[model samples]
Target: MTRSEVRTVLLDAVRELRPEFAGLRLTGNEHLGAELGLDSVARVELLVVLEEEFGIEDEVDPRIFMTPATVNALVDQIVVAEGVCR
Candidate 1:
């Protein structure tokens, strides 16, 4: 598990959640809500799936769903939550 692997997982989850993300190139700067056009419900759904995917038992920060959230920010959060930096 590395940063790139975590990123890939996140992107995959996003693609599953929103098919539009499937063909896009992510530079880690795309905002979750603003840039990605994710509403609150979609964000919550994404959170649920990501937690399941990464086995993140700890609570996720509520602020990560805010407008400024980037793809890299989520990758960092998941890596920290799971401590899967092996």
Candidate 2:
């Protein structure tokens, strides 16, 4: 999938998981944890949603959630994990 497509999917999943974020214009730069206020639980939920949305079954690396993460970074990770060529 293209970056724009990945961004759209990520935004949709994030909105579903966090309705408050629905109004925010999510640039790829927004930090998933710090800026978006996603706690550990929310991050996990987001990852689960992303995995389900993309039909990804492989276990995600826990380290990815250990620190602040950005939308672009997460999308890149998902695209790689899903084995979708850019």
Candidate 3:
């Protein structure tokens, strides 16, 4: 997978996992909670889903998941670190 692919996957996963957040156009740097009306539980759920979906472990910094751009950047970093992408 490439960076764009990772972004697409994350975008789709986010949209699917949080139907209440559906229809909100997410862009890089958008606040995941305030912008999407997500509570702490939903945020944690998203983190878990993202970890499982991407096969990432706990090394991911908690702060990096705060925003869509940061999340995408973190995923890209993990993909590169794990050699999951070219």
TM per candidate comes to 0.64, 0.67, 0.51
Ranking by lDDT: 1, 2, 3
lDDT of 1 by residue, 14-58 (tens): 777778878888787788777776777877776676667668644
Better of 2 and 3 by TM-score: 2
Model 3, range 1-86, lDDT digits (tens) per residue?
A: 46676666666666876786578776634555555555656556665766676676574454545543344555655565556555
| Best-fitting candidate, scored by TM-score | 2
lDDT per model vs. reference: 0.69, 0.69, 0.59
Ten consecutive residues with minimal summed lDDT in candidate 1?
Answer: 59-68
Ranking by TM-score: 2, 1, 3
Candidate 1: C-alpha lDDT:
0.69
**Once model 1 is optimally superposed onto the true structure by TM-score, how far is the C-alpha of residue 77 displaced, in angstroms?**
3.3
Worst 10 residues of 3 by lDDT: 62-71
Candidate 2 weakest lDDT stretch, 10 residues: 57-66
**Over 4 Å off in model 2, which ranges?**
78-85
